[model samples]
Target: MTRSVYVTSIERGDGRQIVELGVMELLTRRVDRVGVFRPLVHDGPDRLFDLLRSRYRLTQDPATGYGMSYDEASTVQAEEGTDELVSRLVDRFHALARDYEAVLVLGTDYAGSQLPEELALNARLANEFGAAVLPVVGGRGQSAESVHTEARNAHRAYAQLGCEIPALFVNRVTPADREEVRDQLAAHLPVPCYVLPDEPALAAPTVAQIAQALQGTVLLGDDAGLARDALDFVFGGAMLPNLLKALTPGCVVITPGDRADLVVGALAAHSAGNPPIAGVLLTLGERPGKEILALADRLAPGTPVISVAGTSFPTATQLFTLEGRLSAATPRKVETALGLFEQCTATGELLDQISAPRSTRITPMMFQHQLLERARADRRHVVLPEGTEERVLHAAEVLLRRGVCDLSLLGPVDSIRKKAADLGIDLGRARLVDPTTSELRDDFAARYAELRAHKGVTLDLAHDVVADANYFGTLMVEQGLADGMVSGSVHSTAATIRPAFEIIKTATPKAGPGTAAGGEPAAAPIVSSVFFMCLADRVLVYGDCAVNPDPGARQLADIALQSAATAERFGVEPRIALLSYSTGTSGAGADVDKVREATELARARRPDLPIEGPIQYDAAVDPVVAATKLPGSAVAGRATVLIFPDLNTGNNTYKAVQRSAGAFAVGPVLQGLRKPVNDLSRGALVGDIVHTVAITAIQAQEPG
Candidate 1:
């Protein structure tokens, strides 16, 4: 039998799409076969259903997901009474359920339905379908007391209809009242009540929506530019200087077409990436000259420059009234919604309450999600030394928005703020520190001098060194100011970690029961790295690929041990393969001997580790090759961690797999450091930085 949950809202504009998205995410995490169904949907394009299908990779046909249109359903209900409506919906839902392990039933939007009692109708349908109810109540403009009362009343209404209410949510509550409302509702309601703060982006209008409302022409813009939400409206009646100061990120500029100066200035501001505006809207149906339009396109490539027949006043009114919709075209909005849902709700507990079984296989998306969930569990503070970098700031916005971790960005405070404002990103509780002008400069210098005194470093030299952002961030970690650090988006790897070697040094693990009499760890400590090679089906750890050009036998052993530990830390079982050109002594050479010796040393040090030696790349991972080459070796065919004989082989193999095989390589994650500090590739994307920062935060959770 297919299990199902009904996501319904009490009133219109409750913003229940966030709840639906959250539930879909949770269900997909638990089961591979999940379906979506809607009892009655509005006419036109079902944007919400389309988004869910695209995002979750649903296979259910759109025609099968819905029972009937709102008009048809209302007519049926009015003529045949409610019984026929409920019976018809139940049949459609079961058809969807038959092919899925779990069905997520999206309830009515409470719009255009002629049913006398919509809430009662939803409760009846949920009960008939034998699905648990998750109700959402709108609290955007309500007081705390009003929200609490409405929530209690909603629960009562559903319960009065004999519906099984697993949980209730009050979304779009004011931030000031969110916590108190949550506490009061949790205490007052029988079921769990989650309070979600109002997200302005959810209510803002996109440029496309604005253009559609005004019946405007796309003078110059693309589909991507059209999809951006117009968070604010900046009318360009003022001079360039004054208008620039008023510009906010995602704001749309509305001006007369004759104001070519304003158009050029706005595009230039966007091109500089200060605060990227949504697009430019030209009023009075007037277009700029040919040269001006060409210059504008070159200034901000692909930015929308819409021309409306309506004047400024009417256009502004229509734009304000036009709200953003949850659609397949607006994926960034989907991310924002998911982030808010995860931040406000007790996702793990809610999933447990929903009783969705956890998945066994870890996909790339799952790995990234788990990294974030773990980091948020016991939140840590991370400092980004490349604060001025655009990618870093973008990642910071995502991190802060999702409540991933507390951030302390190191750069010029004024410059960072201006840049963020120009980009229209919200730092949201992130602390900014100017490394050169911070009051802690002297104290940091003194500490650095003390730590490096044996190197004959004077106070003056220490002061100058500490002024560097990387050195300052490293010292912050050493002095226990931040949990970890992530840099190297622009700086070299050596410049990023050199200070750590001098000050933090390598950590010494505690001796285990099989250690020497002096309580020293069995293996000599060494710093190594691994890339979590995220394939389509599973994640494998490729070690020493980015560090240690050519490690010897003992160093290789240490790298294997560290890689095994790192693999286990990130939730991958370690079946290690010591790789070389030969397989199980089939060939003899210096390379094979080195791998053989390293395997022996690793086994001698950690007898419990599962390891194999002198394995080729094919034999290490391919079961067919393993069956022929090394009959029944445990690690030959299914190694999760591959230890390379030298950097030349490891680097080339990882790059080949990453590029040719289309796998995501998520590291060069530094291991065996005194504190958790990771580096990013110079060409890393925003999502890459976000993942690296999450990895660093998770590492900070462990003992260095």
Candidate 2:
């Protein structure tokens, strides 16, 4: 039987989308094939469902997500009966549930719903689908006592209907009334209750939404600016100076387009980020002339300037009623909603109550989720040297918003801030440092000079080198100011990791009997790298792909050990396979001999670990091939960590798998370093940067 959770609300304005998104996040974290079903939806596009689909990379057909439209449901229930309506819905749900391990059943929204007994209808559908009911109650304008009674009644109502109630959520409660509501509900309800305080940002409308609602023309704004939440609306009826004083950080200034002075003044204030108004709304269908419009564009490059035909009074009333939605276009709001949900809800307890079974296969999405969860578990500070880069900044916003880790972005602080502001991103609590002018520059330069004195490096020369962002960022890791560093989005691998080698150096093994000929312990091999090849069914670790051009037998063994450790650390069970052109002594050559020797050496080092080598790629991965070529080998056909004989083979193989097989390769994650320092592809996307940063944070949590 497939496990499912039915997310419903008692009334309109319950803000149940937050609960829905949060539950979806939880489901995707545990299962690979998670389905989404909406029992009854409006005729138009479903914004919340679209958000879930895009964010989670869901593959469920959009047509299958809905049982029927609200209009259709109303007609069915009215003409035939409630039983006929539910029977059709249950059949539609089971059709979707059959293909998924778990399904998230989205219940009917009570807003404008014409079906009689909406609450009872949702309860009946949840019971029929065998899904645990998670009810949300609105508390935005209710008293604490009223909210308590409502939440209690919600739980009782579902329980009385024979629906298994997992928990109750009281959303959009005032901050002052959250604790009071929780206390009162805790004494009454059997299930756990979570209270989410009201977030004005979630309720605020974006300038684009307002423009669309009013059918206005967008005179000036980019997509990012249009997505800015209009947290407040200020009517611009006064002079420019007084209008500037009324501006708020995310408010939209409404005035007649003929008021050129107010338009330019408000935009100028926004450009200076004095309050950073969300946009300027021009009414009465009167746009400014070319000169004034040009001046406004120069003042605020991406600030929205919308022109509507309505007067200020009617437009203000319309704006007040327009609320922001959680949609694919509003990524910032999605992050905010998830952040708010994670803060208020005990995710672990709720998930336990829901008890969705974990998927046996580790999908790419699940691996990425595990990376974030592990990184967030023990927060570490990871530095990004390319702070001014747009992808890095975007990834920084996501990391900070998700509470993944503390970050220190190395660049000119003002440039980063201006760029972020232009892109409509908020780098909350992220530490920004300029390598050239930071107070620690002198200290870093002196230290670099001392460390490289034997190389004839002078203080001035060292000063210039230390002023580079990668060097400064690496030095911060060396000096314990940061836990790790992730660079190379724009820089070459050498430019990024060269600083790490020069300053942080490699780790040395503990003094033991197997010492070097000079009676000193040997340092570990120069840092190796691994690319987590996330195939459709599982994540495989490919080592030495981005480093180590060629290695002797001993270095090959070292890479194998390091790769296996990296795999196990990230939750992949390590079954080592030393790849060669041959399988298990079937062929002999310098290359195959090296792999065979390395396999023996690695097995000698750790006898308990599953190890196979001198194996053909086909034999190593395909069970049928393994049975024919090398039967009954533990690592054959099920290898999770693959060590190539040299970089030439490893790099080409990972690329082939990534491109030919359409795999999502996550690394080139540098291993064997004293601390974590990962590299990124020059063509990396925003999501790729986020995954790399999270991986770096997790690596930093490990002991040297």
Candidate 3:
């Protein structure tokens, strides 16, 4: 079983970064902890390592991730010999490998290094680390014959070194020659060879690079604008009309500081969306007047305007010399690179060839990934009531980008668009509905009044009440116009769920031993909720956290059953613990008695479930305590679903874990409702909203 992969290049500039990213993304999807190691690193921060660290939330210390710097390696090799250097690096590599399920070993770069025989060194390290090597060859300036030769030679070099070469890649091939090269290499090579076409966007320098290289001051811009790639540079020595003609899409315009006329003209063109430029560079430390600056602000709200002291000649030289590198600071480019790699390569075949070990533990990130993937598999429509809120809009943008579900945002349509524009969020493909004046308003009101007629809800009163966003969204779900609804980002939990209770109500009673015979049928399951408490290594389900305040034994048992079913629905095995202040008759109290009764009732109701009674929090989660207090109990310590005695304990425990232990509480995901309607906390971030919406989509998939 291979535990690591080595991504090396035949030489520098092979564009192996794309392959590295694709591998990391693949590993993360299958495993929780993916470690990164570079056998040799240059002094200072490694851009590629930093990208992997931040993007994947790697916990490995940077000092331990590398063996030695180029200078240190060279010095050690000269003083101690090559064998000693290899041995030392091997020790460092294993140190990181032991901590993770799998490690990705980035091979030494051929650029800016004092180390000798780099290819031999990489192969030796891969051999010692017991790694599979995937070598990359650059084809930017090569023909089909040259590319084929290099690919074969690179594979042979690694194979001769006794390193496992499962597959190979030929990167940066010209678009026209991509297919021919792929065919030729596929025929001759003994292993799979992936050919990637040249991507100009990945090679373009961003505005942030211009600011750093020229040592300029940022006159106006945000982080988003700074990350935009400056594809081409246009010097502003020409007249306004000539400059307008010269402006190309995503180009940076350089002009004298006093060229306010040129500045306004360029910004106006960008505002009109006519070949929008990346940014404007003001030379000679010049700035526009207050009025012109204000106009510039309105014309291009987020475009970068940098002021540099150098003349245009020196600036242009620096800009032309700049080359793009992958980093955490530029996330858009990372997405583009990953998308390109996935599209051009046979990822499934490559992964099978490498055969990375499957991980058992599910990290918080892994849980979130599963949620989104599940939601997208069979997408359902989800409506958001707080569409005008900034966080809601942001989550909607992410949901659309991930293709999680169909979204219908309920609010004033014009206001929602304006809010999204102000936040620079693209609500692409998300439908906007103004509840007050929608074409379905009268139809929805009629339906609502009919549903509540026995409760004295007249048509006039139902019409006015249905205008509220929460009620309107609930109506959409009830009418099957939308599959589910998520709200309460700004509204209270009661305000968000009250409409659901009135319209959707509890699901029609499930059949089984619990059902009645002739007319009325069985009692409906208790309407409860659960918060998916995502810890560092696993996810635990906490029941009745936000909905029920206090319940008797039967209600508590129903909550447990609902929680266990919910747990199984979301991929968690349901070993249930009825939490209390006492464990196994060690203490006596009303709380303990309630938990004890609840556990017995739950077991009677569902004999298939694993249940424990009156278990303390520590005993429920800690194996050592479980062994001491409740010996031989199935769910004493390994419980994944914990049913609290009351809301006070469940809510407080979840909040403490979320704030102190840094767990991500993805719910109060309301269960037992006829239709799926989940509530968000008033302080939920964009990520929390995204996860909740995904969970709701999954819930909507269950048979009602």
Candidate 4:
């Protein structure tokens, strides 16, 4: 039987879409094939469903997502009674459920449903569909006591109707009242209650949404500007100077199209970023002349300028009632909604309650999801040295919006701010540090000099070197100002990791139980790197790919051990394979001899580990070749961690697999460091940086 979750709310305006989106995220994280079904939808496009399809990359047909429209459902209920209506919905739901491992059943919206007793109708549908009910209660403007009563009533109502409610959610409460609401409901309710505070960003309409709602023409601006949220409305009826004073950040300016002076002033102010407005909404269908439009375009390159057929008064009325919807077009809002849901809810416990079976295979999406969940669980402060880079800035926006971890962006503060503004990115609460002008520079310089004193480094030279962003960021990690550091978007791998090698250093091996009290210490660990080859079915670990050029038997064994630990940390079981040009004793060469020796040494050090060596790539991964060449070996044909004898072979093999097999290669992730510091390829995309940052944060969670 397919597991399913029925998300329903007591009334409208509960902002249940956030809960829906969050639950969808949780489901997709665990299972590969998840479907969405709405029992009764409005006539137009379903915004939330569209978002789910786009975000999760669903292949289910849109026609199968809905049972029927509100009109058809109302008429059916009115003519054939509730039983027929529910039966038809149940049949439609099962049609989708049969093809999916789990289905998310979106209950009816009470806004325009003519069918009476929507709460009971939803409960009946949920019971019929055999889904665990997750009810939502709106607390947007309600008092604590009122919200408490409503939450209790909702749970009781569902329970009485024989619906299995796993949890109750109270969304859109004030931040001050969030805890109070949760505590109050905990005392009265039998199930866990999660409370989400109201986020203005989620409620604020974007410029594109407003334009679509008003059916206006977008005269200027690109997609980035259109995505800005309209947090406030400013009616531009006064003079230019007066209008300038009234403009606020993220506010939309509503004025007549003929008012060129006000338009020019607003655009100029926006260009200066005095108070960056969302966009200008020109009313009365009147637009500026070609000359003025051209000038306005120059004033604010990407800022939106819209022309609507309605006058200012009517536009204001429409704007007041319009709210943001979670759709494919609004990605930032999706991040905000997910962040809010994850913060307020006991996600793991709730997911357990939903009880969807985990997939046997680890897809690329599942790997990425696990990375984020682990990183967000124990939030760390990570520093990015390339703050002015466009890709870094965009990734920072995603990191902050998703609440993955605390961030400190290193660069000139003014330059960073200007770049972010031009890109229309809101870096909320990200610490911006300019190494040259920062007070910490002197202290960092002193520490660097002290660490490098053996190299005869003076204070002046150390000061200048520490002024470099990479060095400054590494110092932040070394001095405990930051937990981890991720760089190398534009720098070389050596530039990114050199400071760590100089300051943080590698972990010193500890004394074992059998060692004498005053005996010499064990060999210190070497810093090696691994690439997580995310294949279609499973993830593999390829180590020493980007760090070491050549290694002896002992160092190769050490790399195998480090790679195994890194694999286990990332949830991949380690079946070690020491790759060589030959399989077993089939051929004789120095490289094969090294791999065989390394395997023996690794096994001697960790006797319980599954280690096999002198194995060809085909013998290591292909079962047919393994059976013919190295039969009855535990690690052969099932190796999750592959250690190469040299960097040349390792790097080339990983690149070949990545390009030929269409695998996602995440890393060059450095291992065996005291603290986490990872490098990125110079051509890294925004998503690659985001994943690296998450990986760094997760590595920081490990104890020294």
What CA root-mean-square deviation does each model show from the true structure? 3.8, 2.8, 4.5, 2.8
- Which is superior by lDDT, 2 or 3? 2
Highest-lDDT candidate: 4
Which one wins by TM-score: 1 or 2?
2
Please provide, for model 2 over 1-704, each residue's C-alpha lDDT reduced to its tens digit, 9 standing for 90 to 100. 79999999888889899999999998998999899999988877899889889999887899999899899998999999999999999999999999999999888888787888999999999989999999999999989988888888888888999999879999999999999998888888888999999999889888889999999999999988898888888999899889988998788899998999999998887776676788889999999998998998887888889999999999988887888789999888888888788878888789899998988878888999888878888999999999999899989998888888999998988788777766667776899999999999999999999999999999999999999999999999999999999998899999998998899887665333333445443224558999999888888999989889999888888888878878988899999999999999789888889999988877766666789998988888899999999999999999989998898999899988988999998878998778888899887888889899999999889877
List the candidate 1 regions with Cα displacement exceeding 4 Å. Answer: 53-68, 71-101, 114-121, 217-229, 232-281, 287-306, 412-415, 439-464, 512-523, 623-628
lDDT, model 4, position 434: 99
What are the lDDT figures for the candidates, one per model? 0.86, 0.88, 0.86, 0.90
Candidate 2 residue spans exceeding 4 A from truth: 510-525
Worst 10 residues of 4 by lDDT: 513-522
Model 1, span 570-640: residue lDDT tens:
89998999998889979887878989999987777676778999799899899999999998898988999
- Please provide, for model 3 over 281-388, each residue's C-alpha lDDT reduced to its tens digit, 9 standing for 90 to 100: 999888888898888888787778899998888888888899887899877677668757766776668878999777776667778877876887789999999989
Candidate 3 lDDT: 0.86
Model 4: residues >4 Å from true position, as ranges? 61-63, 258-261, 271-273, 284-299, 510-524
Alpha carbon deviation, residue 293, candidate 4 (Å): 4.9
Give the Å error, residue 353, model 4.
2.9
